[model samples]
Target: MKLENKKVVVTGSEGFIGSHLVEALIVQGAEVTALVQYNSFNSWGWIDSLEPTVKNSIRVVSGDIREYDNIKKIIKGNDVVFHLAALIAIPYSYQSPMSYIRTNVEGTANVLEASRELNVEKVIHTSTSETYGSALYVPIDEKHPLQGQSPYSASKIGADMLAQSYHLSYELPVATLRPFNTYGPRQSSRAVIPTIISQISSGKKIIDLGDVTPTRDFSYVKDTVNAFLKVAESDLSIGKIMNAGSGKEISIGQLFYTICKLMGANVELNIEQQRIRPANSEVNRLLADNRYLKEVTGWESRYSLEDGLIETIRWIDKNINHYKPNIYNV
Candidate 1:
């Protein structure tokens, strides 16, 4: 299923990855409809910052994913649905777990049911490495036992299950694309990459962070977006949960130091208590075994970690005013 001239609806299109995916789909000649969460401010998040031509190319709608009728309506005519909407912050999830359940679990059900009803050609359900929790072994694969160490991850696990069940029970043409830490220009400070870059770019010599010992397999946003397109286009991806990552891991401390080296900043790290996850809840390591996705879609990680970080740093530096270095984003 080539994306050219296909009608695509991207849920959470206002967000970091969603905005980038929307732009990519438009470039691929897909008719795009962007579904941003409703807000009175009429804000489109990162979509609002896109190039005028890119921003104007797609249709944008505001609605809640939790609303079945609304989602069904917006998704009715689209050939492909990329479901990326969810409450993603782990810390915030501790404070409000029910919200995560409603938005992530119930919301995903809405997408699956609506897609089944509409007979959409494909539904690319988004999953996170967080659902795998701390890796029990290096280079985790699709068969790894899911351990939800946090409420946010637990909610995602539920959502992933729904996507898988929908495929088995109803033969919904759905596939779950589980991506390891994705970072790029439009990422908010809630993520570590942006937090580090925003602080250093704001001239902070000492940066506050949490749990630097944990390692993550970070994928550049563009690579992840490519994975989404690949997964949607391949019939081989149907009913499968595939991983996409650089297949490399770096500790947070190492990541921070790398960023400091890249930006030429001598920075002191202060681990803050409030920012730390509960000891048992912390995901200590994550590295992806992306062979299945590569075999299925011929997708590969294009950007090296350093190259991706360099690009992220450049973007955050220019948009430093949009971030608040003093505030802990989560």
Candidate 2:
């Protein structure tokens, strides 16, 4: 479906990916409504950093996704709903599992229920590769068994199940996009790429990180956003779960060295004990089989790891003040 002039509502509009998706949707000439998490400071998160014209293009709504009434009110009259809001920090999930369950699971139910009642045409539910846990084989496909090794992943798994149920039971036009490690500008410091870049940019010679041996299929943020768009635009994507990734995999240690090389910095690596996940909780490998997504939407990743890293480094360097590199974000 053409997005031009279609009414679109993005649930986590203040977040990194959501902000980018909002901007892209605006570029596509979609009338946008952004639902930012309500805060006392009236902060719009990354949306606050958008250019003046871009910020003015959308109607901004301050509300919580966990509230069904609030979500229903916001979702009314929109052609599509992009549900991206959730409590996503895995480390913090260990400290507060209930928060993850309430926000991720219940918040998604609110979106789905609201969309169903309002008869929204489409809903793109955001998902994570973490739900797959450690890949039992290379190039994990959509059929790969989901293993919830962490509370965060478990909450996402529950959310995914809810989306599937909505699609099957209510025939809601919902599609789940499971994106791999999406790294780029404006990502939170809780993520590894931002964590590493912020520390290195802060003039830290020794970079502190968790297990570097775990391999991940890192899709650039731009590519991931494109996948969202493609999925929403295609009728074939409804009632489907697809993987959006680069199909290539890299170990965190190798990625670190590559970033160091790209930045022209010789940095020592320090594996912080506090940074590592519990033995069984850590996902050792992930690679994506993006054939289904490709077949359905004709989408593929556009950026290489080095190219994406260069862009990320440049953005993080200029916005260094936004990061507290000295503290572990979790």
Candidate 3:
């Protein structure tokens, strides 16, 4: 299952984590096709920021994931398919649940059906920590019951179930990789890490945030991408659901404080009602149990939380204009 000389298609290569995964596959000597969302402007999202050398190496395919014809065409003849495309903003999901279902669940179905029809060697389906909602126990495992507290999470849960059913009913060579709170460069401002960094770098004395008591297990984007590569390269991961995380929990308040310290910014907390999730929809905590991933693929977190946060802060500082700190990004 060595990736060298293999043909790999990444469905969301224009996204934060997907772009990183595409770069990793290219580094591993794989022939990479980057599937970017189609636009009239032909924007490649985060992939456009890649170095010329790296960007030139990838084949960019622009199409909608929800279109079965487009998916089948792009999936043809590829040895591995990494399905990372989805609508991920939680707040946006509240505003438009149907969009999430179409993109996350139905889009995933398109990938699975295409892979099954094309007989692709491997399919790596992306899952999220949000699928677990608030942890009923410390260090949630793959077997933990899924509780979708938000429309986004619910959509992802449906996607994961679809992947599982494909593996069981059709014998699709699919693996699900659930990542918890991945953060690094190229992440959008909707995420907490980018939100905090953008606001602090804007010279704002008061950081507007929602409930800070919820905790999450954060992993660096590079580490998460590496784990995806490992899962793709390992036959043992077939029909498995694995987690990529640091296995350490940090509350939002604590995380904000750490980021401020790293950026040398003195900021006070300003609880904004608009920034908060609906009371019933908020996930109180998420801590990953990555034991199965370690046992199956020998993948583990490579970066410490502090190191990753510092790197993220530095990236945001340089790319401040890409973010609008004054407005709450839904």
Candidate 4:
């Protein structure tokens, strides 16, 4: 379970959370390979933001997660594989659901198959709070009912099942690490935190948003990355679903005010119809019960919501130029 000198491959290593994870793995003394999606521009997404020493410590590979042969080649000798790559934009999924299915569902199958065929030590599958949909009960547990309210969440549910099925059917060493609304530096504007911050940072007096009544349990990016590592390092977590969250809930309206208070700005909230999901498709609330994660891996959120928001606000302030506030990011 120790990461020291362990060989690890992280798919989506160029993403917001994935990029941070690569840094953490390096700090933990793990030999790291970062798998970024191949692109002609040769952009490595958020990984490019990493400090030079940390960035240069790891190997970077460019390939599609949907390609089975390429994944097999990368995953063959690694001790663990963290599968985080997927099409995750919810609004875009409505327009292009097939893309989500292929990348989230089928791409996960490719990772599991590679692990099975090549004898990888472990596979860490990334999952979202969206898979649980609205909370029928407060403080949702791993045993809570899963409702896929959107095509994006549905695709993730399919991916989660595929991970579990691999463990049961093929005895693949895999665990699904489910995380709630995680936000921090390097997050895309497609996410609410960056969207709100970008609009505010861009001097927009009126913020366009969808439902503000729904609530969420937000995990800071670092906390989520810690969970990914702790879960993978624990034999008890194998074949199980573990959630990473702050065990707290805040409505979107409350969250907005919190962020604005931190920014010391007064802004008007404008609920745009186009930004709202179909009523039935919207998830109303989510709160995580993280007892099992702590029990198994001694994992708990280290950052308070206010502290994390302060850090995020600072990062976005310096990096706001990367976000386009005039258009809805979805």
**Best candidate according to lDDT:** 1
Give the clash count for model 1.
Answer: 0
In order of listing, the candidates' clash counts read 0, 0, 0, 0
Off by over 4 Å in 1: none
Worst 10 residues of 2 by lDDT: 258-267
Clashes of 3: 0
After superposing candidate 3 on the true structure, give the runs of residues whose Cα lies further than 4 Å from its correct spot: none
lDDT of 1 at 208: 94
lDDT of 1 by residue, 1-330 (tens): 999999999999999999999999999999999999999999999899999999999899999999999999999988999999999999999999999999999999999999999999999999999999999898999999999899999999999999999999999999899999999998999999999999999999899999899999999999999999999999999999999999999999999999999999988999999999999999999999999999999998999999999999999999998999999988
- At residue 179, candidate 2 shows an lDDT of 95
lDDT of 4 by residue, 1-330 (tens): 898899999999999999999999999999999999999999999888889999999899999989999999998788899999999999999999999999999999999999899888899999998999999997999999889899999999999999999999988888888899999999999989888988999999999988999999998999999999899889998888988889999999999999999999899999999889889999999999999889989998899999999999999999888999989888
lDDT of each structure?
A: 0.95, 0.95, 0.94, 0.93
Query: What's the C-alpha lDDT at position 216 in model 4?
Result: 93
User: What TM-score does model 1 achieve against the real structure?
Assistant: 0.99
* Candidate 2: residue pairs that collide: none
Off by over 4 Å in 4: none
lDDT rank order: 1, 2, 3, 4
